[model samples]
Target: MSTAVDDDLWSAVGDPTRRRMIDRLLADGTGTATSLSEQIPVTRQAIAKHLAVLDRAGLVHGATAGRERRYRVDEAQLARAVAQLNAVGSAWDSRLDRIKRIAETIQRTGGGSTAEPDTEHRNEKE
Candidate 1:
């Protein structure tokens, strides 16, 4: 909502493997490192490390289930991430629109040409 970027959260989701893990957990409703490793290319240990990063970013939460911790997506935090992305995207769109308007104005005023000689540079040389 504030367009504030969560660097830690973004960094956690930046990895393609971790995004795949998130997708897997979301699809299955829950997943363990072992289960995810079976579906993903990474080993169970690597999956566990990636899960730790997600946990630290508040993107996913883990609960002890027998020998392994079962993980699930944090819907609220995920929504927050989505809102941030939308806000940033809207900001960029507004900036681009403003730039386009300025360019159109310049073209209409016939100020977009570069045919004139550089009088300043000529004076400097003299």
Candidate 2:
């Protein structure tokens, strides 16, 4: 079963803008919507919205820093995301290896086509 966090996590990071926001946050250690807007091309409101999504995904946490909130990336959640990506990559690699072996076996046996011949059509032609 999939959890809400998985969906939110992927949704948050799927957008280029949010990804850029994360990168900037990582580089700067912590940031506010106003500060991020200055570094990114978007408006402060947009940055805030992206930050909300990231916060929902558990990718970042925000603390009230006077008037504006200061956001920092959550290392543990980021590590979880990395591990999920690695697991998916390993599964694909295993599947590709299986496919390669099957192809090699077919080639060695000179079985160029897997489809069977149409006997009825061949009889009609003959």
RMSD of each: 4.3, 5.7
lDDT of 1 at 107: 91
How do the residues 1-103 of candidate 2 rate in per-residue lDDT, one tens digit apiece? 2222366677788899999999999999999999999999999999999999999999999999999999999988887777776777888899999999999
Listed in order, each prediction's TM-score against the native is: 0.84, 0.82
Model 1 TM: 0.84
Give the 10-residue window scoring lowest on summed lDDT in candidate 1.
1-10
Q: For model 2, give the 10-residue run with minimal summed lDDT.
A: 1-10
lDDT agreement of model 1 with the native: 0.93
- Which portions of model 2 miss their true places by more than 4 Å? 1-5, 114-126
Question: Candidate 1 residues 1-126, lDDT tens each?
Answer: 455899988899889999999899999999999999999999899999999999999999999999999999998888888888788899999999999999999999988768788999989999
C-alpha lDDT of residue 17 in model 1: 99
What global local distance difference test value does model 2 have? 0.89
